[model samples]
Target chain A: MLIRKPADIPPSEITPRSTYVERRRFLGKLASVGGVGGVSGMSGMSGVGALAMAAMSWRPGDAVAEVGAGSLGALVKSAHSTNETPNSLHDISHYNNFYEFGVDKAAPAAQAHTLVTRPWTVRVEGLVKKPRQIAIEDILKLAPLEERIYRLRCVEGWSMVIPWVGFPLERLIRWAEPLSDAKFVEFVSLHDPKQMPGQLFPVLRWPYVEGLRLDEAMHPLALLAVGLYGDILPKQNGAPLRIVVPWKYGFKSGKSIVALRFVAQQPVTSWMRAAPSEYGFYSNVNPDVDHPRWSQARERRIGEFGKRKTLPFNGYGEQVAGLYAGMDLRKQF
Target chain B: MWAGRVAKPSAAWLARIKVALFLACLLPTVLLALGVYQDRLGPNPIEVVTRGTGEWTLRLLLITLTVTPLCRSSGWKWLMRMRRMLGLFAFYYALLHLGSYLWLDQFFDWGAIGRDILKRPFITVGVAAFMLLVPLAATSNQAMVRRLGGRRWLRLHRSVYLIAILAVTHFWWLVKRDITEPVVYASILAVLLGMRLPLHRWGQARTQAAAKGRARVTGPAWPRNP
Candidate 1:
């Protein structure tokens, strides 16, 4: 038998584990020493190109400061939090499916800079007793924010474990004081074409909309997110306000939301409007209920090489599965 | 006559052009390798590589289809010499695409991949397109051409039309929304297919005219020539 010594290995093939393990720390140090200009200079490139450049040059620590300035303050860790190591904030922010900014995964990060998250008001109307526009500042004070790490499953067979900072949607719904007739709650996103360039095209219905059953909306698991990674939300990740419905597909969590309407009828979401057969009203995450174009049984978790078995209700079935009770997930999916 | 009127490059010039074309075809793979080496493929390198290789496969297939039309329009008969190489490059990228899916995306989880190919329409069509290309790629050599004879080989190669359609449909069905890129490729494929209609008719008409001329010269064939 022939044995090769450690010294025989080429230096180029061996990257010290410590160098990669402390890569973010090294990048953070690099950022402090004039790496900010490189990130800013990448803005002129195409969306995916810019994201690639940002991924290479920008430090994850500085990304929070550059985008949100840590406006969210300290968050209490929730019992509902998953133990999984959440995807890097760079991955969560840079690779988004916020179609308001653009349809491409990287478009939101590149184009959402034009979005004005401030001076934002969410109109709480429809079946609510008091139909009025609430300022974002007032909404932030509704409940104590908590960090709940959850698995976000996209319909495209990709998944991400995100550490989201927000309070329950039940708090916001209770604050609104919905009438008894309110059976469903529809979330509507901002619709300014100038800010969200993708809205200029009719790829999806303008002013993207999503909805949930009254019981689903009242579920403690449903979160009204304002921030992520203990920082205020980046414009690309739906700044000001967004919903995080962990049990459902990621698209169900509407971003850059400007309105929350309590309605009696099941709202026709933008996805449902575009392709009724593919996207349904009750988009609960189910591995058994495969998407028409691809399988939902397995998913490629971002930053990971191989796929893992996608769980039913994204592995929150114990808590939220009761909401669907005896319904057919396949038909709904 | 028009083809003769055009200037043909010398053997050395043609060889250099072939070399350049081969390198040009290999550029995407080289860049992809550099991306992997530099760790510039973003958070999901497998997804990037898969998508990149798949896209290049479609692009090269479209470029391969364009060669015939270009030769017809420009009377550059030499262009056809590069078609098989372009087509094989497309096959190479397709192999890389499948390799990424099997090795990187699925990690050799044959059961999962089998289920996906069976259950998913996108995967089914993509795999079908790749499978169809296998025989075409296998027979791309001059030895196989001589073994099968030109007519049978040509007939077998015609399946490329079906492969192209399946490849486009694979892309079209995979997208969730915003079908702009797929639409653009589909339109190019449509134009290429449409161009073949007129060329096929022209070839048929020329063959019929030649047959008629031959018949006119060999009149009264029923009578004994001796």
Candidate 2:
């Protein structure tokens, strides 16, 4: 009966010396460039410039400018950013629930290297007025990438604060120009088993799909993330492109998206198809409404000990509460 | 009864093997301790520990159940000596699994734990399995066996089969998807439980044969008709 304590990471180890210095250097560079508004001047920048400014203000301690085949030019700090500290990049990348690589938490990091992110194109079709295939390169430059630190609450009773670099999904939806009749948006992940071994298994139907109400998709809080921690997203963390719906369960935010379909009807998501009784269409984070298998009232935040009381909508009630104001969360959940 | 007798190991050899088996049974806990000490349990150490202890509990329970059939088929009577120890070790791991949930996962929050045990079917079955193991573990000693008599003791201990089933069901219900691990455990348990059916029938046949033999020697209580 050896009672050893959980790993006690020192402050220095949490943010490595190199990362700390790099963050300081980036902040100093932002200050030296007087023409470009510094952190405070981000509000003054207009259109995509504001987003670029926000990207410039992004201070991932160990920010890497280049990711895979592309360079993430500048990331501005988003007004939507959560004040909570983001989990370490190691923990964030190493521990994931991306089933496309494998079901095990550690499986993605090990098996995701085989995935080919480049030469990727997302098809935006269905009820959209202007249906088109958007290449990954063009998607990255579609809008100024902002650093949005959001609380990602998984359906499995675990939570993490992630600094995601991407523009709002609204931007992409606008580009696609969905028809007025489009009620829901469906995201289709890559279905190539040759690239994603997990696809070989019929785990929730291949080409993992997720959906959102057109309004939820248009919410400013819903982001199409390209990178995390100011660096290009690792393959395991859904590299190339993924959606981030902060208020909903992490599974609602589809990863490594290959297509966006604007549909007139509510699309049957992968998880909903897998277990309709457990997962619902909305999948918003409601602490009161527990998952059928486990309690959702409390959640264990990554890198922290003990559980904390889970907040309704993961504490994003202020922003997204209106969307579900009259709806029955329990019924939807 | 199914196979020819195998050579029994020397007492000294048996003792050494028992010690090795004891250490082997304890290895999972040791590795988990090392993981904690070295901080290698990853970000979610509690989860790792919880799952590790629970998996070992199920495995040890299945291994303990294997001894009877293994000994019967292999003609290794010496293995029977290890069954109690193995069963006890299974209970030991069960205790650790429950301890981790209560102390680490719930932090002795009885209200939360109670709600989980009552509300969640998985936790309910898991707690039920552990509760049933308590009586078996208590009566595992020679004294309790002697006091209760072999027949009653055996009947009481038969509950282990139910406990094993409950443990597997608990695991089956808890997994979100990817039931491969639970399915494997359940299959092993199914095979172990299935093996007992023939042995039970054989025992029943033997008892009937013994009773007929006694009647033939002692004569029928009532005289035969002319």
Candidate 3:
């Protein structure tokens, strides 16, 4: 199965923008003939953004460089970006699951869009050999985007399939060059309620921390994401930065992040600290292991709520199950 | 239960009960506020905590009300001062419960929410109890009772009996299966309702008739208090 690469971004097309209205009229005029804009630019097939991105030929070098991880990467070798602009699909991506703003799952999405991401600095600290503040842009420039379509399973019995554009956390951690004492890495989301109104309510601890065991952090499947759905990660989603750990529950994937600390011990996690019995630090999405108050055996797949069956390991169990060998997930969970 | 003050409240008795009631009412609010401030309320704790507090408030309100009738026949008027604060406490928790449902659960999805209010039987009864409490809550004060006329306000607040019954039904329907808690609440409600019956003479008449029938068979006691 061909997975989506991180940069399947519609290069120049503005499908949902106000400018899409004007472009639609122009595309209408073009399609009035024998469809001169070619198959990729056809509005009837791919989204106007995808088509427009396809239509406009970037500089030769830029084209090869940007589209290097093309066609949704390994997930879908042949699938093209559809014209169906379901904002709700994108909406859920932007909206659900961030607690830096509030404990309510959707509050961060509603409140976090106002965050100023530029001029933001991520402090790399703790057991790292070179503890330094790095700009988010500096981190993004390190590796060209790659595609990874991971199944995201939330603790609240919901799941989603997201095509994320990111470098592997392993890649970034290797560069961070932590000392031998580094046994874990913790991530902290920005905690200002002046921009994130939900933080003002004191739902969860302000910074919303998440951590990974050193081995887990260095695991190749762990992703350090900067964007999704072929665009800069929307402000509600996490804006400039976030983490995506497909094997674990979604909370382990911290959002609106600003700090990465390689630590010597198990780091503080947001939900686990909020209620230890209910949310464990090792929040692996296991169907057999039920949350203390709720069941994890079933899940609502957001858009396809009633229809979709929540598969074991969100359908990626074959890829990630080996990570949790002989260990009993229920106990760790 | 103070042996000395049981006969009469005296000067400081009402004041002491007032202090106790005020603290009981204020402490929960303080703890909940601190939990909110310190990020202590776990994810999705609003629903559980809200309902728990409301259940406690309603149970306490009934207990406080029962005190008056308990003391009247049992001569315990010292129970009076705590009733208002307890009733207000019920209203306070009810307000938080409603706010949680509105802001957190519903997210102002007004149309779907309105449909749920109409469609869901438990929600209907819950809303009915909530609506009934509003008038009782508004008329809680002596000033409001004076303004509305004490007798009229008393009649209006009598809706609380109906509210308690609806509350029991709401609790019963909310739990999918295990109803041990609701059954306990229902038993307490039954006792509170039963207490009002003896006050109305229906129960007294039944007891008197029973006593008279017994007297005809076994004769009266040799000595009486009178």
lDDT of 3 at B2: 81
How does model 2 fare in lDDT? 0.81
- Per candidate, chain B TM-score? 0.90, 0.91, 0.79
What DockQ does each prediction reach against the true complex?
0.23, 0.21, 0.02
As a whole number from 0 to 100, the lDDT of residue B129 in candidate 2 is: 99
lDDT (C-alpha) at residue B140 in model 3: 77
- Select the stronger candidate by TM-score from 1 and 3: 1
**lDDT, candidate 1, A1-333, per-residue tens:** 122122223323433323442464344333222322222222233545534654576454553343344567777867777666566677788888988888878888889999998899988999999998889899989999887778899988889888788999999899889999999999999999998888889999988999999989888888999988778888899998899999899999999898999999999999999999889999888888877777788888886545789888888877777777788777877
Local accuracy of candidate 3 as per-residue lDDT tens digits, B74-170: 6555555566777778777777666656554555668856866876777788888888889888877878877987557767877878888888888
* Residue pairs in candidate 2 whose N, alpha carbon or C atoms collide under 3 angstroms: A54-A75, A54-A76, A54-A77, A55-A75, A55-A76, A56-A75
Error of 2 at B168 (Å): 0.4
> Which digits, one per residue and each the tens of the lDDT, describe model 2 over residues A174-269?
989899999999999988889899988887798899999998888888899999777789999998899999899999988999999999998899
Best prediction by DockQ: 1
lDDT of 3 by residue, A91-192 (tens): 354446665555545566567667899988888899998888878878877776764556678776656556576877887787788999899999988888
lDDT of 1 at B21: 98
In terms of docking quality, how is candidate 2 classified? incorrect
How many backbone overlaps does candidate 3 show?
A: 21
Q: A280 in model 3: Cα distance from truth in Å?
A: 0.7
In order of lDDT, best first, we have 2, 1, 3
Off by over 4 Å in 2: A1-71, B1-6, B214-226
